[model samples]
Target: MEFIYTNPIGLTDLEVLEVGTQACTPTMKFGPGVRDMYILHYIHSGHGTYSAKGSSVSVVPGGLFLVVPDTVHSYWADPDEPWHYTWFGFVGTMAARLCKQAGFTGSPPVRNPDPSVPVDPLFSEVLSLREEPAKELLLTGLLYRILGTLTVPDDIPPLQPDVGLHVRRAVSFINARYADPIALADIAAHVGLDPKYVCRLFQQRLSMSPYRYLTDVRMRKACRLLRSQLPGIAEIARSVGYADPLLFSRMFKRTIGLSPSAYREKAKLENTPSGT
Candidate 1:
């Protein structure tokens, strides 16, 4: 079963686009092709070979292989013991950086999880979240947790004293509460800073005012929901914190350069697979 999720919202760090499990038929293959996003497949059972950069790696149960964006690669199930696996596709500004941090940054990018790590439950939870609505936040958190386990604590550099700690906190606040009737003062209060100081920090760190950042977060989520085509305009508006559908339409078009319905149609066309 496979489900696609475009609800990125305020998850600027990483955005999960799709997740699924598949039991490959004998010798089934894909690629010598490229993808626009990163895909990570965990081999649950059976065998396969993943080839890239002129190298091939044999993958077995509990192994993981990563397909990097825009890189040509190919994989096929073993003719005798075909593989079953769970996979997720994702993309974001920070995706590649995080992938490196998780030790996934090389040719034929396949590796077995550390013996002490428990990864099955994390992937299982991702599959479960596929069946739920409004799972963007949960999915992002889960992905971070899963990647964290794959990383060596000693290899990770210790954090420096963050001068922008308040800015980061304020952004987290907006990410968690964008659907509510929130304002700059509320964000400032959450970060224990004065409203004007918060505004200055946002401008210095993010190059935008607090309200502009909030609108951007709301508009991004609105775009995703529109593309999904699963909710009415009014419902999508409310989900992104707008009480009035008309106002939401105006803001969406202003920020995204198309009405919600128009954007949906365009996304559908673009997302349609090559043939069917």
Candidate 2:
């Protein structure tokens, strides 16, 4: 087996614990060891088998396997075809949550990624980087993009009957209090429905999850606030139900394609008088 790169870094928020690529021989097998941080392997080619505590999964090209923090696991390459894969390890409070978006919390993180997408390249970039401009900021941004692009097969069942009414109720509640620290459970309770069912209704009726829709409302409000240029980004973030300024910035950039500061500047420029 060969590891293209192996290194660890230090960053508190969303740190890259390690990054590398490996080419395994027909007989290669990795151990029943565990890691301190979350790790995932994206199969670039060939196939392999991953075994966790009480579960195992088969993976192929474009597939991925996730190792949750401190989980004993083993993996081996297919004897006939072998396997070449790229992997990275990460750590942070948001690590598990972000990974869950890609369906990585399941038996197998079956990330059927688009070949043309930049997910693989992101891993390679992390592997290649010795240093970055504002390391924490840069790596965090990249991780967000990587997680954002992660797509799994939609195996969820279709929306249930009369779910639309609940969805509408949830929307109405969110519109009335988007700046509050509302949660899925709160919305479900408001609509007198289960949270998972509410999520399905949003998915089927609006093609977005309730949290996403809440974010949409918050971002729109942020735009209006940015145009007014009345409050600091931190204050604006708080006004929109976000407590962490950095997280607010990340979410703003992800949803709006521009940082809050940049968006505010742009808004200022547009709202300025012709002579001024």
lDDT of 2 at 16: 62
Local error of candidate 2 at residue 223 (angstroms): 46
Q: Tell me the spans in candidate 1 whose CA falls farther than 4 Å from its real position.
A: 153-276
TM-score of each: 0.58, 0.48
Across 16-76, the per-residue lDDT of candidate 1 in tens digits comes to 8667788898969987887656898888889999999899999998889999865789999
Instruction: Please list the C-alpha lDDT of all candidates, in the order they appear.
Output: 0.79, 0.72
lDDT by residue (tens digit), candidate 2, 26-87:
99887787654577787878888898877777888877788875468889999998889877
Alpha-carbon RMSD to native, per candidate: 7.7, 15.5
Clashing pairs in 1: none
By TM-score, who's the top model here? 1
Please give the TM-score that candidate 1 achieves against the real structure: 0.58
Residue 69 CA displacement from its true place in model 2, Å:
1.2
Cα deviation of 16, candidate 1, in Å: 0.9
